[model samples]
Target: MPLTVHQFPCLEDNYGFLARDEATGLAACIDTPEAGAILKALDTLGWKLDLILNTHWHPDHAGGNAEIKAATGATIVGPAEVTRISALDREVKGGDVVMLGETRFEVIETGGHTLGHIAYFDAADAIAFVGDTLFALGCGRLFEGTAEQMWTSLQRLAALPDETTVYCAHEYTASNARFALSVDDDPALKARADHIFALRERGEPTVPTSIGLEKATNPFLRAPRLAERVGVAGEPDYKAFGAVRAAKDVFKG
Candidate 1:
C-alpha cells in the first residue's frame, strides 16, 4: 500500500513531512525542522513519530532532532554526517534501505547542498523526500559540493519515474518561478509560472512538484538547454549547470 504522507509548513518556509506506513501504522518524520511544529502535526494527525529521517546535517533540517527524539523517543536515522550537527540512532548512506512498516525507502546519495546529503525514494509509493537537493522549479544551492557534484546528484533524481512526487524541503517555488520565467520562453513554462504566482498570492504551497514537471521546467535538470536559453550554448554540461547555479545565487527574483 502507498504510504500516507502529510506535509506541513515548518519554521519559515521549510516543510516537515510525516509518512505513515499503512500496513504497520509506523510513521516517520522526514526531517526535524522544528520539534514543536512536528509534534503538533503528529498530535493533530493522531500518528506517533517512530523515526526521524534526516537528509543532511544542516541546522534547519536537523535543529529539532534532539528535542523531537526526547519527546517521542523516535529512533533517529540519517547519514552518518548528521552526528556532526545532532544526535542520531542509526546512520545510513547510499544504497541502504530504510523500512517504515512494509514501505521501503531506497536511499540515494545526493551530495551538493551538503556533501553528505541523501534522498529517500519509495518506488512503490512513487514518492521522494528530496530534502534541499531539488525543489519546485529550482534546485538547492551548492554549498559544500561543487556544481558538478550537484549536477550528478540531480541527474540521479531526474532518473526517477516521471510520476514520482518530489517532497523538497523549502517553499521556494515563487522565487524559482520568477527565475525560470527570466530564462525560459516556453509557453508551457510561462503557464506553470503564472499558476505558481497565483497560488502563492492565495497563500498556497507549490511544492510536491512532479518529476515530469520538473524535467520540463526546472533549469537545473535541463542543463543542456540552459546555456542556449541564456545565450551560452557552447559550454559543457557542468559549465552550463554552474552558470545556472551562479545566476540563481545572485538572482533577486
Candidate 2:
C-alpha cells in the first residue's frame, strides 16, 4: 500500500508534511515548520509521530524540532550538520536508507540551498520530499553552496523517474512561474504558468509537482534552455545555472 501523505500550511508560506505507512501505523514528518500545526495534524489523524526527518539546518525547516520531539517523543533523523541548528537522534547521509514501515526512503545529498542539505526519495512510492532544494518552476536561493553544487544537486533530482511526485517545502510556485515566464516563453511553459496562477488565485496549494513537469518548465532545471534569455548562451552548466539564479534573485516579476 502507498504511504498516506497529509499536507498542511504552517508559518507564513511554509508547509508541513506527514507521511504515514498505513500498514504499520508508522508516521513521519518530513520537516517541522511549526510544532503547533504538525501536532494538530497528528491529532486529527490519530497518528503518533514516530520520526522527524529534517532536510537542512535552516530555522524554518528545523525550528520546531525541539518542541515536536518533546511533545511526542519522536526520534529525530537528519543530516549531521543539522546538529548546528537542532537536535538529531540519528545522522544520515547520501547512500543511506531510512525506513518508513515497508516503504524505504533513499537519502540524496542535495547541498545547494544549504551545505549538507538532503532530500528523501522513495522509489516504491515514486515520491520525494525536497526541503528547499527544488521547487515548482524554481529552485532555492544559494544560501551556502555554489551554483556548481546546486546544478549537480538539481540534476540528481531531475534524473528521478519522471512520474515522481515532488513535495517541496513552500508556496512559491506563483512567483516562480512568473519568473519562469519572463525567461522561457515556450507554449508548454505558458500553459503550466497559467495553471499555477489559477491555482494560487483560488487559494489552492500548487506543490507536489511532478519531476516531468519540472523538467519541462522549471528554469533552474532547464538552465541550458534558458541560457540565451539569461545572457550566457554558450556557458557551462554551472555558469548557465548561475545566470538563471542571478536573474531570479532580482527579478521583480
Candidate 3:
C-alpha cells in the first residue's frame, strides 16, 4: 500500500503529525508539541507510531517528546545537533535517510530558524516536514543563524520538486500573507491571503502548501534579487540577506 500522513493541530495552531505506511503499519511523528493531542490523532487514525522526527529544538516542536517517547517507545530521530539539546537515539545529517513503514525520508539541513533545523523530505510522496524554516508565505525569523544561512536554507527547499507538499509546523499562512500583501499588492497574494484569513475567521488550517504555490506568492522565497539590493554596502554574507528579511519583518498588512 501507500503512506498516510495525518496532520493534527495542537498547542495554539502548532501542528503535530503521524505519517504511516499501510503496507508495514509503521508510523512516525514529525513533531509533537502536545502528547495528548498527538496521541489522540494517532488513535483516531489507528496508527502505531514507531518513530519520532524532530526538526529542531524549539520547545513548541519537541516539548511532548518525553511523554510520547515514554508511551510509544518510538526511536527519536533528529538533527545532528540534537545531541546537544535533547536525548536522541540517532543524530541525523543532511542526505541521511529515515524510514517510516514504507516511506523513506531524506533529511534536509535547513538552518536559520535554529542553527540545526532539519526538514524531512519524502521525495516519492512529494511531502516535506519543515519545522519552522519555511512557512507558506514567509520564512521563520532568524533566531540563531544569520539571514544568509536562512536564505540558503529556503533556497534548498525551493529546489525541491515543485509538486512537493510543505508541512510546516505552524498555521502562519494568513499572517505571513498579510505581510506579503504589504510588500507588494500582487493580486495573487492578496487573493490567497483573503482565502486564508477567511479560513482563520472560521477556524481552519492553512498548510500542506505546494512548493509551486509558494514560489508564486511567498515573499521570503522570492528575495534573492531584493536581498542583493538591500545588502548594507554589500556585506557579502549576513547583511545582504538581512536587508531583505528585515524589510519583511517590518511589513504590515
**What's the distance in Å from true for residue 202, model 2?**
0.9
**TM-score, candidate number 1:** 0.98
lDDT tens string, model 2, 114-213?
9999999999889999999999889999999999999999999999999999999999999998898888888999999889899998999999899999
Segments in model 3 whose C-alpha atoms lie over 4 Å from true places: 225-241, 251-253
Per-candidate clashes come to 0, 0, 0
Better of 1 and 3 by TM-score: 1
What value does the lDDT take at residue 106 in candidate 3?
A: 94
Model 1 misplacement above 4 A: none
Local accuracy of candidate 1 as per-residue lDDT tens digits, 42-122: 999899778999999999999899999998999999998899989889999999999988999999999999999999999
Best by TM-score: 2
TM-scores of the models, in the order given: 0.98, 0.98, 0.92
lDDT of 3 by residue, 1-253 (tens): 6678888888887988788888899899997688999888877887888998999888788778888989889999997666654688888988899988778899998999899899999988889999999888878899899888898898899899999999988888887877677665567888888898999899878888989988888877665434445545545544555676788777665
Best by lDDT: 2
Give the Cα lDDT of each candidate: 0.92, 0.93, 0.83
On TM-score, who's better, 2 or 3? 2
Give the Å error, residue 134, model 1: 0.4
